[model samples]
Target: MTRKILHVDMDAFYASVEQRDNPDYKGRPVIVGGPPDSRGVVCAASYEARKFGVRSAMPCSQAARLCPSGIFVTPRFEAYRKVSSRIREIFLEYTDLVEMLSLDEAFLDVTENKKNIPYASQVAKEIREKIFEETRLTASAGVSINKFLAKVATDQNKPDGMTIVRPDQVEKFIESLDVGVFPGIGKVTLKKMHALGIRNGKDLKDKSLEMLDQSFGKSGRWFYAVCRGLDDRPVEPYRERKSLGAESTFPKDLENSEEILRELADIAEELERRLLKKPFPGKTITLKVKFSDFTQKTRSLTEDYTYIDKNELYRIGSKLLGEFLLGSGKSVFPIRLLGLSLSHPESSSKITTVNTEEEDDLFPSLF
Candidate 1:
């Protein structure tokens, strides 16, 4: 059976919301994040800011250097969550099979929707119009027979646009798209493919399955399947988070231990803020670091203690780094990225005893 999926993505969501609420921010370079002087990173950037080469996850200091006059605003999650709920409500009115990808994006499986909208393109249009009318916000919608194509079509025309990939046109559409446009293909993957002389979907489609497998292993199989417009991923309404974490790539690598600690501390603070909302009372804290050479390493510690403070996280993370330095016998040169993650500890009930022994076994001291 053919499935009709509609992907709706808001343009520059966080920055856009800030602009919408404040009239003065409209049509201006607005960035959502911490102050530039504090070594913060840009969480989101408005389209106006994009003109100055500003982008999300780019260091706030670099963004300021790019656009000195850009306005900076801390994220307002509560406000954005309220807006997200309103949008989701609008989506549910058309289809019960709604899968939210993030706070500002979702996919609607309208094949079995109440409206019985025979044409997926019509459903996408109506949804966009209604969203604009009710929320005074512009949305881009992609209509396709499946999720992957629908997502691609939605991005074809951005900032209040819509695109449709009909059943008959799926093959041509997939063939014409750039390989980098496919989900899960990051900068590193793209670079590797470029070195292999693969530039676009057509080039990727030309490669043999064995060649892909030899290069990317299991992910190669997924790439081959998607190149033919085939994806079996379903749109489930329930939200299940597989992982929650935060990471930052610095504009330039830093070598000083002091600077690295300061940066890690900032990232830990952001993680705590996000975790507090979910009451992420997990016992495992993992530190992920990527060196200037692009070598990545992870060190996890499961504690008898639960923590959500920057100071505690920094202390543990610093210890892990120390251990790595001692083992590798190589000093950290320039730091590229730092990440922190937490996982739920095994437990039976609220009154259960803490498994101190199990915790020790889970995290062995590197020293």
Candidate 2:
């Protein structure tokens, strides 16, 4: 029997929450992030803002430049998380095989769902309707026999779109797709593929296994499978976040040292909230920055201790930001994006295991 999977993604989740709570924000370009003066990046942009080319992870300052009249506000995760919880509650009503990809997205296995919906397309539609009725927010749903195709279907339509791919159509659909559209094909891979004259899925399908293996190592096998429209990965019920982070890009490149530090503080605060709730015992605190030309760099400091407190983590992040910003020799370009992440140490493996089991079993209803 063919399996069924559904991918549900909330449209403009953070910005939508802000618009929902504030009557004045309706129909306006709203950006949820820090102030432009603080070297802020766009955390999320409303559809109105998106019309002007503003996007999440873009610089808040640049977003304002795109739509000068847009309203820029800091993110309120407490409010957003409450909305996320409501959305998750809706997913559980259908299936026990619910896997949350993030607060705003998830995968549902309805092949044996409690609601007994036989057609996966019908299940997708119901999830979309329920999200709208309960949350007053729009969502996009994708229905297919596997995770890969389902995710692809979800993106086919945007701002509340639904797409369904039957089992038989999978191979044909993949054959016509662009290589860059495949998941895990990053900038580096795109460059390498271009050099090899492999432009799309059809080009990829022509490669021999030995050739692909030589180029991508173990990943070559996975790439070969994708070309044949084969994915056996299950709809994971729970995914413990390996890291929790918040990042923002600047509107204009930021050469200002003071502004960069301020944005880091804001990202640190958001990361802190996630850490406190999840109790990340990891020893690594990583800082990610992207330059104006999209060059990215990451710096990390690992400690022997796990941190649950917000203040201590913030201090360390601030210190790291200073170290990077106050370089003696080279002049730094304007900052485009800043990110902060906290990873627990390996020593906490036992605790992490316990937490994972508890989250999956004890709170199965929460998925």
Candidate 3:
């Protein structure tokens, strides 16, 4: 049986929420994240901001430079999470096969939904309407036979839009797609593909399997299948999160070890709050550092038992940061980002014991 996959993404989630809560922000360029004076990145940019070449993940400072008049606002994650929960409730009304990707996006497998909806597109339409009716926010949806096509289609007509790719249209759709737009093809990979004259799906299809394998290894093989619209990856509704983490980029890179430790304390506090909200017993604590030069590294330590003690997390995090600084020999002074994550809890083992096939049958392409 052909599967019915729907990818739903909120349009400018954080920015839109800000605008919705504050009528004065409506129709104006809103940027959410760290302040422009700090070394932070843009978390979300409104459509109006995007027109000024502002984008998520771009440096907040750069975004400010791009749109001098843009209103910069800090993210209200709690509010966003509340909306996300509400949206998930709506998804559950139709199917238990909903796989949340993040606070702003999810993929639903409605092939055997609770509502017994016959048309995937109709399910998507109703879901969007329900989301708007409850939250007063816009969502874009893509409906197709598999996750790949559904995800790509979601972006075709965005911000309160829906696009459907019927099974019959899959082949032609794949053939005409630009190679750069295919999932997992980054700038570096795109450059390599261009050198090999693989500019589009047709070009990718023309390459021999052996040649592609020699050029790109396992990813090449995966690309070969995806370019032909043959993605069988299941939507795994039961995929357990292996780790929970939070990170922050500073307004200014930290040059002093004391300053770094202070920042780590604040981050640890935030992590504790998160753990309290979604309590997890993780034994391993990992610290992430991104230096000013764009180089990144991680250090971790494991305990005998899982715990979520704030002081312990902070102690471990600070120790990790101290060790990194001491090892640096005063060289790598400025650090752009710092992060903390908890993992390797006892519950994770139990996650794998669930019936994989059953989960797959109910949900597709969760990861």
C-alpha root-mean-square deviation, each candidate: 8.0, 10.1, 10.4
Best by lDDT: 3
Each prediction's TM-score versus the true structure? 0.74, 0.69, 0.69
lDDT of each: 0.74, 0.72, 0.77
lDDT agreement of model 1 with the native: 0.74
Arrange candidates by lDDT, highest first: which order? 3, 1, 2
Model 3 lowest lDDT segment of ten: 357-366
As for lDDT, the candidate ahead, 2 or 3, is: 3
Best by TM-score: 1
Tens digits of per-residue lDDT, candidate 3, 85-161, equal 99999999999988887788888999998988899999999999999999999999999999999988898898899
What are the clashing pairs of model 1?
Answer: none
Off by over 4 Å in 2: 243-300, 303-342, 346-367
Q: How many residue pairs clash in each candidate?
A: 0, 14, 8
Q: What would the TM-score be for candidate 2 when compared with the true structure?
A: 0.69
